[model samples]
Target: MLAQTIVNGLLLGGVYGIATIGFSVVWGVMGIINLAHGAYIMVGAYIAFALNQWFGLDPFLAMPFAMVALFVIGYALQAFLLNPVMHTSLLLTLVVTFGIDLFLIDLFVLFFSSDVRAVHTAYSGSSLEIGPVLISWVRLVAAILSVLVAIASYLFLNRTRTGQAILATALDREAARLMGIYPDRAYGLTAGLAAAVAGAAGCLASTIFPISPTLGISFLGAVFVVTVLGGIGSVAGVIIAGFAYALVQAFAATYLGANYQQIVAFSMFLLILIVRPQGLFGKPFYGES
Candidate 1:
């Protein structure tokens, strides 16, 4: 039973880890908290839901379409609002993102009617058993996809010219500008990429969990907690922390009781913050003033 629970936790963590990476990138490089990230995921899930309901499209296939739509939304948002404030106080950025989150939630509620919905494909509930451990196929696929995306993101950050430019821009905008890299353009691309990843995650989440306009708050909390615990800019750290969080949640849910799961998560977060404010893989300047 324990092993099975651990496996389930690990699978869930893998998806959470990938989804959080998008938040990490936007926060780490752009220095923007992007409070609307969960909303982006929520919107993406809704897009998939719409596609599935209206056109009978498969959830897996609808993901790319949702990703593209979100990419455009992110690009436009950064190019117009966030890019202008990159030079201002961080609090301003935070406020702007918070506003965006509120706007998005209301927008979704207006359009989707605040109904709780979930993708109900036949395979969503099917599982494969290995010994005593039963693994849901959807979760396994999500886990594999999450790991692949994280690895790809890592490679993009470490290997490509544009990627390097983005890193330089994040580390020092002025210096990056001096080197002929346009900070605004880089920021837009980064936001677009982050949005696309969030879209994919949202689509997957729709397949596994109930979707509602209000669920964004809880998901945002989970993703942010994992991101902080792992490190703001570290993809590898996020992956590790995601699994760690999942394990903690699963164990707490099964042993300490589900009612106490939130308390455990928060307690661990508090303990980590007190002991290692920089986080497990966070840098010295994380959440820098």
Candidate 2:
């Protein structure tokens, strides 16, 4: 039982990490705590759901389409709506993003009617038996996809020229601009990439969990903790902190009941904030290699 419990948590950790990476990236790069991030994921899940119903595409196969759509949405948001007041004040940015989140939620509610939905692919409830531990197929697939995406994101930031330019621009706009790298273009691209990751994660997560218009915001607290714990904007940090957070939640759910899960998680979040504010994988700053 204990082994199975641990395995379940491990699988969930990947999803949790993937979900928060978008939130983390936006914060790391744009200094914006995008409340709309959950909405973005919600949008992706709906896109996949629509594709599945209309064209019979597997939810997994719909990931790229969802990602592309979200990238366009995110880019337009940052380029047109956000850039004007981005540097005005932190509170203003927060309020703007919060309004954006609310707007998206309402829009989803209007179109989708806020119904709880899930993607029941061919292998929805099937599981693999590894001795006494039975792992759900959907979970295993989601975990694998999450890991691949996370790794790809890490590589993108480290290896690609555009990524390096983005990192440079985010860390120090003036310095990056002096080197002839445009901050506006980089910022827009960063937001687009962040949303794209969220879209992919949403498609995978829809296979494992229910989808709904309001389902995205419920994750805000947990993902915020994960993002901070993983050292905001660090892919490796999110992976490490995600697994740790999942393990904690899994164990708590088993031993302390589900109600205690959030209590315990938030308690740990406070403890970590007080003890090591920089976070598990947090660095003083990110620079190109």
Candidate 3:
């Protein structure tokens, strides 16, 4: 039971980690807290759901299309609506994203209603028994995809030119501009990539959990805890922190009750904030005189 619980937590954490990476990336590159990130995830889930319903496509197979759709939406939103106000106050950006979130929720509600939905595949109900642990095939695939996406993201940032530009912009926007890197372009790309990842996460999540228009709020809360726990800008930190957060939740749910899971997770979030605001892997911004 203990080992199985640990494995379950780890698997869930991987999916959670993937979902939060895009949120972290947008913040890391653009200094925007992106309150609408959950909307992107919701949109992706709907897209996959629609494809499966209409075209008989498998959710996993429909994920790319969902990702692409979200990428376009994200890119357009950043390029047209956000870039103009990029230099504005942080509060303005927050309000903008919050408004966007509300709009997305309403739009989805209008179209899909508030009914809970899930993706049903042939392998969805199947499980693998490896000695003492039994793992669901759907969850195993989601976990593997989550880890792969995170690794790919890390490699892209470290190895690619556009990614380097994004990192450079995050480090110092003025310096990045002096080097002929357009901050607007980088920001757009960052937003698009973030949305794409979020969409993929949503598609994977639909396989494991029921989704609805309002489910984004729950995901938003999870993203906040994971992001803060992992350190804002570190992919590796997010991944590790995600697993840790999942383990905590899993143990709490198993021992205490499912109702206490959120309470424990939030309590840990508060503890982290009080003890180490910079997070486990985040760099300290405050300098000693």
Candidate 4:
């Protein structure tokens, strides 16, 4: 039972890790607490759904389209809307994002309705048995894809010129600007990349969980806890923390109850904040002390 639970947690954590990477990137790079991050996830899921419904595209195959769509949306939002207030107080930025989040939630509800949906594939119900452990095929694929996404993201950030510029901007915007890196363009690119990652996560999620207009809220909460726990901006740290959190929740749900799972997770989040505000792998950002 313990082994099975561990495996389940690992699978779930992989997906969670992918979902939170975009959130971490946006926060780490732009110092923007994007309350609309979850909205992007929701939009991605919907895109996959629409593609599947209309053209019979596999969720995995439709992910790229979702990514492209969200990337454009994110770039535009940052360039036109968020950039104007980029120099404003953090509180104002937070409020603006919050308003945008609310608007997205309402928009999703109006268009998609509150109905719950899931992507059904031929292998969704299949499972693989190894010794005493059973793993769902759909979840296994999602987990593998999640890890690949993380690796790809890491490579992109380290190898590509644009990615290097992004890293430079994240480290010090003024220094990056001195090096001829346009902070505005980098910021927009960062936002777009984050949205692309979120879209991938949402595509994976559609295969595993039922999605709804309000599902983004729950995902947003989870992302917050994971981002803080893993330390903002640390991709490897996020992956490790994701697995740790999933294990904890899985064990809590198994031993206590479903209701206690979130309670325990949130409690741990609070304790971590009180004890080590820097998080497991977090370093102080530009303004942070």
Candidate 1 regions with alpha-carbon error over 4 angstroms: 285-287
C-alpha lDDT values of all predictions:
0.86, 0.87, 0.86, 0.87
Give the 10-residue window scoring lowest on summed lDDT in candidate 3. Answer: 280-289
Query: TM-score of model 2 relative to the true fold?
Result: 0.97
Task: Give stretches of model 4 more than 4 Å off.
Answer: 286-289
Better of 2 and 3 by lDDT: 2
At residue 250, candidate 1 shows an lDDT of 91
Per-model TM against the reference: 0.96, 0.97, 0.96, 0.97
Backbone clashes for every candidate come to 0, 0, 0, 0
Q: What is the lDDT of residue 253 in candidate 1?
A: 89
Could you give candidate 2's per-residue lDDT for residues 54-156 as a string of tens digits?
8999999999999999999999999998888776775587888899999999999999897898888888878999999999998998899999999998899
Model 4: worst 10 consecutive residues (lDDT sum): 280-289
For candidate 4, what is the total of clashing residue pairs? Answer: 0
